[model samples]
Target: MDAQPDPVGEPAGSLDPRAELSEFLRTRRARLKPEDVGLPDFGRHRRVPGLRREELSQLAGVSVAYYTRLEQGNGRNVSAEVLDSIARALRLTDAEHAHLTHLAKPKLKKKQSGACAQQQQPVRPALRGLLDTMDSVPAYVSGWRTEILAWNRMAAAVFGDWGELPPQERNWARLVFLRPDYRDLFIDWEQKAIDIVCMLRMNAGRCSDDPRLASLVGELSVKSEDFRRLWATHDVKEKSFGVKRLHHPLVGDLSLQYESFRLTDGTEQALVTYHAEAGSQSEESLRLLASWGTDASRAGSSVRRTA
Candidate 1:
């Protein structure tokens, strides 16, 4: 009748859902203004940046003490009705509401035998072939943890030679936080870094027990001040479609739109493809980059055969 020990070196602790909920609520509350939420300004100087606890409780039709407890992470059995009312008072978007619910009720961690027990599934040959066929676009496959599982030649040309890195170093978040070259590559580096952290925070909720993810987060937190600051904001975001601006060393500035699709093959993988608008300067730059990549690949192959 004793509790079992957690898997080896998997960290001595798991994520604290209540703490996450508290931080998220605080940040969201701080971002709202009295006038923005249809509350009257009494012309009195305010100490806080956003609505007061009493003001929020009044708007949500809840008692100040109860809302205070919720904000303090002590509302153990918050009902759906109360949550909905709070969401409405906060004027949360659909994504924000879902994220609030997740923070309030995080998924339970799964028991794993060991750190290496959960091996990454191999990318399907068909998917790899599909990537290769996208000669004009940059594409790659990523796992649930945002690690690059597979990438095409165009992806390498556009995003640097990912194949040169070890598998553990090929992660998107890792490249964003740990590599100066990647930071220099993006024109909107600050926004991109924040978005990457938000996506990682969202994934951390679902995979709190994954050692690889935990390690990545810890490393970033310790190494990058920006990562630490953004991570504390408790933002959550899903990576879907978005526009990115990159300043490739070989091709100058380019604007690319990316789409992400979940794979059907049950491995919880996603295929992300990046493309430029037709007949645009970015499209021409992409073509030039792809040609350079192709020539470089062939030269490397020839050298390997000579060796």
Candidate 2:
């Protein structure tokens, strides 16, 4: 039987850096086999699922003792070259490699007062104006932890009005997992869940000390089994661009392609916009939805979900 996902034993958002690094490397190592690294797999029964410490160290050109200590969560003295070598050995993607580096060399946390820690990041007026100018495109600004800071009318029409939701509930993680209506809106709910969890994992590595993030992770871990399972996979990815299929209550169906651009405003905010292909049925449905304008309030009200 597969091992169960470890519980969020620490308080929400307060994951130990060492433990995070340890589990991430272990999960990554567990997915590989000796044959994967060109090593002969003798018919001897294996004691562990994936490559052993000696095998990985040999592949990475590092000492077995050092690799063992690093895998055991003592990565403080590890260098970038060693990390890069190990990343290559594990065949980690760019995003996964970056996540590993962050876990190993976390930035110093700034002291935050109670109010400052919980304060919401405001979308710049210029950025908000840019979102508004994208008339036909459904656009929104997301801050750290996938918080929906600002959105345009088209976005509200397709994804429900974030303006109506409390700031805490205006997050992608909360909307996708906590709200039943949002779950039903996605055609591939499992894929959507995986994407959201991957985003959260990225955020956890980047801002592991954010208490609000910890609290959100803790709450989701306790409330949603799907969240708990996906969270344990140690997957790290950014949803920079993708196609999403949705079963909109009013529009019937929508196939939208989205692009995410990072803002250069010295903050961790991204501008995400969605558009359907020109002259396609999805385009027509999107156009019709946009035409609903303020009237889409009715559809939003119909599918409004409560936590």
Estimated TM-score per prediction?
0.84, 0.91
Candidate lDDT (C-alpha), each: 0.75, 0.80
Q: List the residue pairs that clash in candidate 1.
A: none
Q: State the lDDT of candidate 1 residue by residue for 1-307, as single tens digits.
A: 0111112234435556677778778888988899998999998998878989999999999999999889987646787789899999998877677677656654322321122225457788888889888888899988766778888888877776666666667778878888777787789999899888877787666555556567777777888998998898877777789999987766679999999897766666789999999999999998887778766444433433343
In candidate 1, position 27 carries an lDDT of 85
The runs of at least 3 residues in candidate 1 whose Cα sits more than 4 Å from the true structure, single-residue gaps closed, are 1-12, 107-120, 209-211, 264-266, 294-307
Strongest candidate by TM-score: 2
TM-score of model number 1: 0.84
Scanning candidate 1 in windows of ten residues, the lowest lDDT window is 1-10
lDDT string for model 2 (1-307, tens) is 0111112234344667788999999999989998888999987887878988888999999999999888888988788999999999998999999888878876433221122244445777888788878879998887767778788888888888666665567778888888899888899999999999998898777777766678788888988898999999989898799999998877788999999997766567788999999999999988898888967845764665532
- Clash number for model 1? 0
